[model samples]
Target: MKTFNYHSAKDVKEASKLASSSSAFLAGGMTTIPSMKLGLATYKNIIDIKGIKKLSGIKVSGKAVTIGATTKHAEVANSKEIKKAIPSLAALAEGIGDPQVRNRGTIGGSIANNDPAADYPSACIALNAVIHTNSRKIDAEKFFKGMFETVLKSGEIIEAIEFQVPQKSNYQKFPNPASRYAIVGVYVAKHKNGINVAVTGAKSCVYNDKDLAKTLSSNFSAASINNVRVSSSGMNSDIHASAEYRANMVKVFAKKAVEAC
Candidate 1:
């Protein structure tokens, strides 16, 4: 691994100042550290945000549930507030990579990284969660642009994610055998606006299944998805699975989530 200077910031302001150039912010370091070590990423400095107290915890209000950025996946999975407000989110967090990954992978890192196959982004999109940054809050619908890309600006750190309490929600994933990253993951939720279906791992970015969403919005039931045809036109293709296979999985998961809800 290449050598680098390390600094532990006292707060968001200090952390942001250090994150300008050739620097990476460390929350859980579940992915960042490994990428850096493999030379997939290079950094002159590593800013540890773990010491910043504000970036950790779970708080649930009548309006919404706010999860601090540095809070680990394991913590989210075990949070009583989350389990009570939206149990599917906890179940989804519990299903991420493995025990080690869940214990160290923070929701903020996972969503900010916007990994094509990661689970949290699906939940964020489906729930219409608001991503709070040091600078300002961005809606989930506007936050994600593409793979590993977000609207988050330079020196801006994710402070927390606020999820609007949904009427019903469910998440389903077909995980790769060893790595446990989803081959295809889908999150479905019924909100004030409508039913939203966010599919992950099928492509380089999470996409809303408007057809399924419309169907579910009309009738929140598994039978409603029977006539829907999931398209394979823009899905990912590789040795692990074909674009058609991922498309098929999306339909299956949508049905499963409806049944689950």
Candidate 2:
């Protein structure tokens, strides 16, 4: 890693103030540290936001569950409140990388990095999550831009994410054996308003499958989408899986998610 100035920020104000084009705010450093080591990313200053007490916790209400920015994956997986309110979310957290990664990774860092195959973004879309930042709030749909991209601005820090509670929900993924990142993941959420089908890992970005959602909203069953043909256009293809294969897995996992729900 290159030399950089490390600053321990005590609060959001300090963290945001330290932010600049050449600086980064470190929460869990799950992605940041690795990128720096690989020379994929470099920063002049590293602002440690984990010391900011207000940025770590879980809050549950009847209508929504609010998770602080620095809340670790393990914390989310183990929270009784999270399991009770959103079992799918807890399952998602528990399925992340591994014990070390889960214990160290934060929800904020994962979402902010916006890795296409990352699990949290799919949950955010399916659960109708709102990302609360120091400046303003952004809907989940507007928050993710593309692979490794997001709408977060310079000097802005995410404070928390609030997910609307659903009547029923489930997540299913075909994980990469070595990394555990999803090759194809689907999250199905049934709400009073309607149903949401969010898909990830198969494309350049996580997105809601409107066609599947519409179909499921009408029938709410795995068989309803059995004949639904998912197009392979714009899907990622590599050594692990082909675009067509990934497209098929989307449907397969969507059905699994619905069945699991």
Candidate 3:
């Protein structure tokens, strides 16, 4: 890694104020450190946010489950509150990468990085999450811009993520064996308002499958979307799987998620 000034920020204000155009807030450093070592990215300053006590915890209310930004994947995976309130979320956390990554990676880093194949983004979408930042709160639907992109400003820092509690929800993913990153993942959530079918790992970004959601909202069953065809257009195609195959897996995983729910 290249030389950079590292600052261990004590609070949100300090972290945000320290950020510059070439600065990055360090949480888990799962992606940031790797990218730097690989020469894919470089930062002039690394503002460590992990030291901020306010940025790590889990809060479960009757209406929502709010997770602090720096909460580790392993913490979420093992949290009794998370398991009792949103088991699907805990399951998703358990499925992220390996034990080391799970212990080191964080919810904020995962969502902020916005990796297309990431598991957390699908849960955020399906659970109707609101990203709480230093500046403002953003809806999960509106937060994500595109591939590896979010609406987070240069100096802004995510504080927490609040997910609306659903009546029933489940997540299913076809993971790439080597990396455990989803090749196709689906999260099905049935709320009082309606059903949400969030799909990831098949496109340039995670998105809600309107057709699947509409069909499932009407019936709320695995068989309800059996005949619904997911189009291959705008899907990712690579060595692991073809665009058509990934598109097909989207439906498959959606059905699995609904059945699990």
TM-scores for every predicted model: 0.98, 0.99, 0.99
RMSD of 3: 0.6
Residue 175, model 2: lDDT of: 99
Off by over 4 Å in 2: none
True-vs-predicted CA distance for residue 92, candidate 1, Å? 0.8
Model 1 Cα shift for residue 13 (angstroms): 0.4
CA displacement after TM-score superposition, residue 171 of candidate 2 (Å): 0.4
Instruction: Flag regions of model 3 displaced more than 4 Å.
Output: none
Q: What is the C-alpha lDDT profile of model 1 across 1-261, one tens digit per residue?
A: 889899999999999998877888888898998898889998888999988999999999876889999999999999988999999999999999889998898999998899999999999999999999999989999999998999988799999999988999999999999988889998999987788999999998988889999988888889888888988999999989999999999999888998998
lDDT tens per residue, model 3, 1-261: 789999999999999999999999999999999999999999999999999999999999999999999999999999999899999999999999999999999999999999999999999999999999999999999999999999999899999999999999999999999999999999999999988999999999999999999999778888988889899999999999999999899988898998899
User: Over the full model, what C-alpha lDDT does candidate 1 score relative to the true structure?
Assistant: 0.91
Better of 1 and 3 by TM-score: 3
Clashes of each: 0, 0, 0
* Window of ten residues with lowest summed lDDT in model 1: 18-27
lDDT (0 to 1) per candidate: 0.91, 0.96, 0.95
TM-score of 3: 0.99
| Candidate 2 local Cα displacement, residue 247, angstroms | 0.4
